[model samples]
Target: MNKLLAGKRLLITGAARGLGLDFAQAACAAGAQVVMADILDELVEQEAGALVEQGFDAVAVRLDLADPESIKAVAAFSAARFGEVDGLVNCGAIATGIGGPDMCELEIDTWDRVMTVNVRGTWLMSRAMVPHLAASTAGKIVNIASDTALWGAPRLMAYVASKGAVISMSRSMARELGAQNICVNTVCPGLTLVEATAYVPRERHEHYINGRAIQREQMPEDVTGSVLYLLSDLASFVTGQTLAVNGGFVCN
Candidate 1:
C-alpha cells in the first residue's frame, strides 16, 4: 500500500458502489483510515469488510445525504472515530438514471430531489465537517461533479444544473475555508463507466469515446487519481479550483 495518505483519516460519501466505492478503496490502499458512508448500510459494510480483510483500515457507516440529521451524524461519527479528519470526498448524489428529461419537461420533484442531494446536501455536508476539518492541520474537501454540466449535455437538465451548482459551491467553500487550511475543490468527470451510469445509451457512450482527447470510456480509476491528489498534502496550496477529469471531453 502506498503511504501517500499515511496517518490521514478520510470520509467518503456514497461508498456503496461506483465512484464512491472506488474512492473508499483507493483511499484505504493509499494508507488512510477511511469511514465509508452510504445509504446502503449493508453493502457499504460489506465493502469495508473486504478492505479490512485486505489489511486496510476502514469502517462502514450509514449516510443519507438527503437527510440533514444523517449528514450531521456522519460528521460526528468520523470525528469521534478519528479525531480531526484529514479529508472529505463528497461523492453522494442522485445521479443514477436521472437523465432523459429536457429542461422544460423535467419534473419539479425530480429537480428538487437532485438539488436536495447534490447541491444542498453537499453544502450541508461540507458545512458539518468544517469544524472537524478545521481541527486538522491539513484539511481537504473534494466535490464530485460531472462534465455534462460543463458542456451542457441535453436531456440531463436537473443533473447538469445540480452539478453546475456544486462546481460553483466549491469556489465559495474554498474561499471560506481557506483561513483554516482546508482545501476545497471540484472534479468534473465525463460519463464514467460505473453502476450509476449503466443506464446511459450505447450511442451516447460511443459519442463520448469518439469526442475525447483520449478516445476511451472514462472509468472510476480515471477520476480517482485527481481526487486523491486533492486529498493529499501535495495539493495543500491548491484550492477553489475545478478540475475537468474527463478525457478532454469538456476542457476546463
Candidate 2:
C-alpha cells in the first residue's frame, strides 16, 4: 500500500501464479497499471480477470518468453494499451527434466530448452521492451534469479548456469541502460516452495529451510516486497544489484 508505483505501467512475465502472481497483486495494490503475462494463456487470463474484477488495473496476455515474436507482440500490445511501460519483471523460468536423460547424462535438447527459456527469454523480453521502458523517467527491470546459482546445486547444472547468466546480464544491462535512467537489477529467491517446485526432492526443500536465518518455508509473497521496492521510486538510485530475498539463506 506504499503507492510508490502509482501511475506506473508494469509488465510482469510468468505472472499467472506463484511469485509472479504475488508480484502483480502487490504492484496493482500500489496503484500500478499492470499487464501480466505467461505462456499458460488460460491461467494468465483467469488471473488477470480475477484481479480486474477486484478493481485492479491489470490485464493478461499470452507471452511465450522463449519466442522472440511473442516478446515483440506483448511489447506492442502493452505500448498500445498503456502508452508507455515504466517497469518490467522477468519472472518466467524453466527448471525441469533432471535425474537417465538427467544431470549426469542431460539431454542436449532439454539443456537448450532451459537456456532458451531462462536466458535467451530474459534477453528477448528486455530487448523488446527497452524502448518503451526508456520513455519513462524511472523505468526499471527486475529479473528473478535463484540462489542455486550462488552455490551450485547438484543435478541441476543447466538451471544454475542459466540463472547465473541472468545475474551477470542484469549488471551489464544496468551499465548500458544507466544513461537512460532505467535501473536493471536481479532478485535471487531462495527455496520458495511453489507449485513449480513440487518436483524438487523433499530433502532439497529441507536443506533450504534448515539453512535460512528464518527457519521456515518462503512463500511467494516473501519475494514480493523486495520486488515492489525495486520497481518503486524508493529504489530510484539503486541499480545492477543482486538482492537475495531468502531470509538470509546464504549471507554475503
Candidate 3:
C-alpha cells in the first residue's frame, strides 16, 4: 500500500517473459527502478523498451547466466548505470526441456548444464551484485526455486537437484549476508503456467490441478505479489526461509 519498492533500484534476471517479466512489472508499478536482464536479447530489449515507453524505470540487457564473465560485466554495468542495486530476483534458469535427459537417460552433461544455469547462475549473480546491494538500506536477494525440490518430482531429477541446491545456497547466503543487512530467501513456484512449462505433459498439469488443495492452476501473476513482499521493507526480518507460492501443491 505504501508503494513498498519506491526508490528501490532492483535487477531481475530471466525477465524477458513469464514470471520474471511479471515480477518486473509489479516492481515497477510499485515505483522501483527496474533492470530486466535475460538471455533473449531481443525480447528483453523489446520488453524493456515497452516498459520505458509506459513511464517505468526499466532496461533490458543481455545476460548469459552460464558465463561468469558475462555475469560480472552486467553487474558492473548495472552498478554504473543505477549507482546501486537494492534488490535482486535470481529468476534466470534453464528448464529441463532445454537439454534435460530423462531420469535414467539423463546425461552428465545435461546435469552440468542445468546446474550451471540454475545453481551456479544464481550464486554468481548474487555474489556479483551483493556489494552494490549492501549499499542499500533494504538489500535483499529472492531466489526463484521450484516445487520439484519440495515434492521430489520424478523425471525432473536434474532440475530438482539444481533447485534443491538453490534452497540450500539461499540458507547459507542468509547466514553470511545477514550481518550486511541483506535478507536472502527462496520462493518455490509450483506448476505455474509459464512458457517454460509448455513442454510439460498435459497429464502432469492435470495432476497438479487434481492434487492441489486450491484446485486451480497458478498464473504467473499469482507469484508476483509474494516476490514484491520479499523485496520490500515488510520482510526486513524474514530471511533464510523458503516460501512456497504454489496453489497448495506442497503446503506445509
Candidate 4:
C-alpha cells in the first residue's frame, strides 16, 4: 500500500519526547521525511538517529520556541535537509506544573513564558515555514492545543489562555494562508498521559478519564491519527477547523 505522506518533508517541534516524538514517528511511518526538533538537543538527536537506524528518513534540529532566531535557524536547517517543508506540527508548549497558579495567584512571568512559547512561538515558527509550505503542492500546518481551552479548566490559567490564543490564531492563519493553498488547523487533545503530564495528580487523571466518552486513558498515539489526517491530501479542503481528539471530552 502506498504511504499517505510519500515524498513529503514534515517538521515537528517539541519532538524530544512525549506527544511530539509520537508525531514524528507517525509522520515517518506514513512516509514523510521527518525533522524532529526540540530544545533538548541531545534527546532530539538521539530520537532522530534511532528512527534513521530503523530505516526512516529522519533528522534532528535544536529549536528554542522562545527565541525567534532559533526558530529561523531550525527552519533553514530543515529546508536544507529536505529541500522544502511540506507540513509542520507545532507541538512544543509550556504548561502548568512549574508555576501553574490560580487566576488570583498567577504570576506575570509565568503567563509571559507560556504565551511566549505557546502562542508567539507557534506563530513565529509558522511565519518562518509559510514560504516553504507554500512551495509544496500539499502544504499543511497543525497546531497542538489542549481540551482545557475548550472546557475552561480551572487553575491552569496561563496554559489555558495560551492554548486559547492558539485556537484563535489558527483560524486567522487558515484564512490568510488559504490563498496560498496551505491548510492550517488545530488539534485539541484531552489530558493525555505523556511524560510531560506525569506531574498531574491522580485524581485529575481519573477525572479526565471518567469524563471522557471512551472511559480510558488518553495516549499520545490517540491524537496522532487526527494529525496525520490533517496533514494528508484527504484534508486538503478541511482547513480553519479545530478537531478535538479527547475521546468525546469536548464535542464540537
**Each model's TM-score?**
0.98, 0.96, 0.96, 0.97
Q: Write the per-residue lDDT of candidate 3 for residues 1-252, one digit (tens) a residue.
A: 358899889999999988998899889999899989999999999999999999988998999999999999889988987998999999999867622466889888888999999999999999999899998867999999998899988878899999999999999999999999999999999988988888888888888899888898889877999999999989999999999988898984
lDDT of 1 by residue, 129-237 (tens): 9999999978999999988889988888888889999999999999999999999999998889999888888999999899999998898999888888999999999
TM-score, structure 4 vs. true: 0.97
lDDT of 2 by residue, 1-252 (tens): 778789989999999988898899999999999999899999999999999999999999999988899999999999998988999999988886333144778878888999999999999999998999999878999999998888877778888889999999999999999999999999999988777877777877788899899999898888898999999989999999998888888774
How many steric overlaps does candidate 2 have?
Answer: 0
Alpha-carbon runs more than 4 Å astray in model 3: 98-101
In the predicted model 2, the residue pairs found to clash are: none
Query: What's model 1's lDDT at 152?
Result: 86
lDDT of 3 at 205: 88
Question: Candidate 3 — worst ten consecutive residues by lDDT sum?
Answer: 95-104
Query: Which ranges of candidate 2 are over 4 A from the true structure?
Result: 97-102
Give the range of the ten consecutive residues with the poorest summed lDDT in model 2: 96-105
Query: Model 4 scores what on Cα lDDT?
Result: 0.92
Candidate 2: deviation at residue 176, Å? 0.4
Which model is ahead, 2 or 3, in terms of lDDT?
Answer: 3
